[model samples]
Target: MNFDAFLHSLTSSFTPVIDSSFNPEDYIHVDLSPSNALLNQVNLSSAEDIELFLENFLRQNQKKVAYGGYLEKRSIYDRSEHFSSGSSVQRRNIHLGMDVWCAANTSVLLPLDGKIHSVRNNKNFGDYGPTIIVEHQENEQTFYTLYGHLSLESLDRLNVGVKVVKGEKLGELGDATVNGNYAPHLHFQLIKDMHNHAGDYPGVCTKAELKFYSSNCPDPNTLLKIY
Candidate 1:
């Protein structure tokens, strides 16, 4: 069944900022460019300092941290990875969702009232890291949302079939070690069917698979509306 409209109808309610009492909605939508705090500093010199800088910055600013499609779709993939050896254009795919780059303990809220269908630790570098999937119903239509790069402890308090309400704080984003082995960030994606699985879904898509993935994973901005 075509769920585009079902998905579109829910867009009007997504708040760009989680925990807005502490963090403002405007700050969540800002693009802090070239800041070492947001973008990783590339320095051939002092690799140790670079490591320290990422860890320190992540610790301090994981909350209120900002980065998005500053130029074109820079907030998303850079298209630097090789699809093959030498194919064609290095497709710089546009990012459909907003990323909340912050510390491990930053809390994530349930965007809407839903039931916990599945939860698992992806446990791979650059993976969802730790993930949660929720099945939600609005107007008798059922859909899902995937929350990735979450803290390990978040799963400790949850179980399958748990009922979560709108604006309820679900879990915190994990650290670099557990969160896909990169800088800490929340990889949130809204999905329709989830294809009857749990614990994970493709956070990134390839050029060849763009058409299918795009439809399968509709623009999160529809729900986020942060931009």
Candidate 2:
């Protein structure tokens, strides 16, 4: 079976990646793409500005979690030079992971049983701060799950090859000061191939490279089933 089909077969119901106390109803789909006119009113460069926007968005929608953005073309990345390629067409703004926006320190859980593959502190600006990659094998097929923007303390106890079960507490979300200077959120992604990457992988890509990146990194929602 194909990767997408394999992911779908792993779960028949909604999978919680954060605070299990929250019901699936508590999550509201958020649009962070450039097409969202509402974003134009806020300063995308400021983490505080983005945080306030998310706070208001969740409050207004009566939801506790705001999630979406797999393969979404976002303009927020423009604020950081890390995503700039000096050419508009080559700018890396297409998000490759599903972002779960909520309060800082929120518990991030594993959606599937896996073992710790690698961990690192990717301290680059506009990058995933404390990241973890978990390796999984089923039906003789091996794959990986990546958790990014985690609290620094989360890595204090993690070790390679540590066994973690589905629904296990992987880590807590980090604040802006540590999590790539963005609003607090979990950047969750699935990878068919690690490409020798450890605790880090390109979570965004330029339009010209979308074809390959999109195929290597599938939509995370296929496993989360939050939509």
On the 0 to 100 scale, the lDDT of residue 91 in model 1 is 52
Q: Candidate 1: lDDT over CA atoms?
A: 0.63
lDDT of 1 at 185: 65
TM-score of 2: 0.98
lDDT of 2 by residue, 1-227 (tens): 89899989998899999999998999999999989999999999999999999999999999999999998999899888889889998999999999999998999998989999999999989999999999999888899999999999999879999999999999999999999999999999999999999889999999999999999999988999997
In candidate 2, the residue pairs with backbone N, CA or C atoms under 3 Å apart (3 or more residues apart, or in different chains) clash, namely none
C-alpha lDDT of all candidate models, in order: 0.63, 0.94
Best candidate according to lDDT? 2
